[model samples]
Target: MTRLRLAGLLLTAAPLALALPAAGQAQPAPNRTLRVAPHADLRTLDPVFGSIVITRMHGLMIYETLFAWDSKLQPHPQMVESVSTSEDGLAWRFRLRDGLRFHDGQTVTTRDVIASLKRWMARDTVGLKLAEYTAGLEAEDERSFTLKLRKPTGMVPFALGSAVGQIPVIMRESDAATDPMKPVTETIGSGPFRFNRAEWRSGARVVYDRNADYVPRAEPADGLAGGRVVKLDRVEWTIMPDPATAAAALQTGEIDIWEQPGQDLIPVLSRSRDVRVERYSSLPNQGMLRPNHLYPPFNDPRARLALAYATDQADFLAAGFGDEQWWKRCGSYFVCGSPNGTEAGAAPYAKPDLETARRLLAESGYKGEKLVLNSSYDIAPIGRMAEVAAESLKKIGMNVEVQFADWGTVTTRQQNRNPVDQGGWNLFVTTASGATMQSPITNIGTNMACERAWAGWPCDAEAERLRNAVVEAVDEPARKAATEALHRRLAEVQPYRVLGQYDQPYARRVNISGVLEAPVMVFWNIEKK
Candidate 1:
């Protein structure tokens, strides 16, 4: 698993002078404003339309969920005041928390909540499944709503409060009414912070101002739940693609926090007494290689299988993370170290077999068609994974063409469903939070609902049936059995290949406090002292 040259492949530090601010640019206020170097720039503002983590983070900044997960991953009411379930668990009633208002001063209503859920259902994997069981979702009054289910299930609150994938955020009815497939340009929400759209610069910076009218919950802050007290007046995200430049900024106190510093740059940051590196969540980040199932080569199961045989999890983990202490070669479709993380069907492709890969490629009837591999050079780990995958694919006698771009551009281009000649993509490498992959229901990669599936769009009826089994199981033992069956189905279907798992540690200044531990990054509780 260890590569001799892996350490050298990691990012090397650049001179601290490279991170100096432009002349005449205003400096960030000492304790009032907190400037952060985000891993990627803000491109997609519509949370429902984009499945990227950055978009989810943006959504959390200005939008609130009905329920949210605490640090322990337990569902707790956030925007909802209370929920009551029927004896059969088929019917549920929800009451909205008082004083909830959009940024425009409009009161939050059942109309908005229902519309937002409908929009979210059209996109989110869990929401899609929830819609299947929903008999009716109607408003009882302005602040209350009722959800009648066709069958009994206990996944309602968990699905609504999901912290990973595309979150079910409450938006204005007008914004939620916009087609789920299209982007909602307006950023109006009733969360703790308001997006400063006028101050946003695409590739450079983004700003958010504390929502003065926001009423924090009476409870103490915990993960994405409880009170979201805004201690700082403003939060600014400074896009720094280069790890070296970000490290320099953190060391010089130019940036209050660096969301994800490259593994190689950790030493550079550790040397600075002012900067502290820490893991935000206990769950590891799992890497994945998603193939366009609609396309020719990948559309064939054998071709996809060829990818599985050729993929070396060790190569990916070593290349992307460099440090063996930080990453592991995980074969689980569900994240390794998680409850349902079993390697049931992973035995066949546990190790790379170039001979088997070539055989599978031949059986798939693939000629010499070029496979477009979309990759991002802006993010270190993703870029390394792409490089390793391209090399592995070429070894299997596949025509692999790597298309390099910034993370934001790669994310946008991946949405294209056209042929490669018409700007479509064949494959792309990305990572999901381990928290999202802990179960069959939460993991978006396991979705095989054809058109409704995530970007890759891999459809398998058996996989869908198996996932439903896991969702419908009555107890832990039954659920585990169903999950293992689903995991086996996923391995055979090869919807998305799990490369490996690694911890992504965040670095911040010592003065920063109150950073909550959650699956994804949120800006509400942190304060710069």
Candidate 2:
């Protein structure tokens, strides 16, 4: 499976010199430590439990997957030595590579891979679908495993090589044996870096030491796959909630990289000759306004549709990205320019009309109920979207209460299902990469299964049926038709509001090299000169 390609829109600015140390100033050697200011703090270490962006980066540092998606979105063997299927298509065999050792000096075994897959399939949507066809998953020998399916399904390799948040990463048998719902306390893997557990401080800083015993693949680096090379002896990730502070730190050479820089600070960073700003992925980050379907106002389909129709994409786009070149007004539920993106049956959200929203709210019997909107001040995009949404809702005559917190806190609070007065939320802002939204199988946020739905808990039988159809589709045309039909139903059901799509850039020192332009941020091939 080739990696999905996104738009070619990119932003790169010439570097300008900032006042700095004189020539006499002694500079530290650049071959050891590489400090970075990530987008968010590391709140959770477990990859499955920590589905956020920051933790996903941490997962890449410590863990290694059997098969990983390349720059073309194609799956390549990583830990696995080879994979072959029987002529009957009922059984698939996998062999592990030699000389693979965990952090604790244990050999990577087929039993460990089987244990890891069992845990990942419990929560991941692709894993659940694969489980439906899988009759048994067991170790064939110490170095190999076999997956027996009740019927032919060609999705096993793709599911195992998922590039999104819920990646099927391998672990030691002891750690992999833990309950899927529970968080693993131990961090041990055979990746290029080993977690320095003693140096870890929750919400503050985390450190990783280069693995001396690890060996890289002979193939060159390509996206998430290929060689795992670590040039730096130590990598440090420090948490800085304020964008201005992070930019200042980067300017002073205190930090080597800033994962997600604020759009407003791009000009300031551009003035510094030491920093270089570039978009890592071609896919833009999509803004989303998710409403809790279990509560009032949004529970009514009319009320939800009103919010979507009342939202002006231009307003949200400007607020979040500010520049026309950095953002695009995407009217479709799926990404606008992607293969699966379509505007079918999307007449209601073409324009924003305050009068239409007011009428819909009145028909839903809304009596000025307070809508709790969670805003994350730490992330510029999320905060800006929430602010614009609050003002838009007020114009429609709805009571709005904005709750401000950090990104991690907002992520934690959005999962609560309690009543509004009991610490529950009514609305929140989130963003997804275009790669995650390109197809129904990868887009977990759109799941509408009754009690097993994603965050907002939308229960739409028609949408669920359409989502399944897309997954079971035989080819591209069939999948496209199902996706188009899903979009038509989504417009009427109004599970969530799409707040346009925008691009984000990463700022790093000019001396750093070997940075791959991939969706997920990986530090393996990166080297600081």
State each model's CA lDDT, in order.
0.85, 0.78
Task: Quote the lDDT for 285 in model 1.
Answer: 88
lDDT of 2 by residue, 130-209 (tens): 77678999897888998898976556666677777567888888888988877787889888888998998877898998
Listed in order, each prediction's TM-score against the native is 0.93, 0.90
Q: TM-score of predicted model 2?
A: 0.90
Return the top candidate by lDDT: 1
Model 2, 421: alpha-carbon shift in Å? 3.2
- Per-candidate clashes come to 0, 8
User: lDDT per residue, candidate 1, 1-529, as tens digits?
Assistant: 1111111111111111101112211212324899999888899998888878889999999999998887766667788876776767777888887889999999999999999999999999889988988998989999999899999766777788888878899999999998898989999999989999999999999999988888877666788888788888999999988888888889999999999899998888888889899999988989999999998888988899999999999899888888899998888988888878898888888898889889988998998788899998888899988999999999989899899988888998988989999999999999999888877887888899999988889889999999888777776677789889888888887998889899999999999988899988888778787
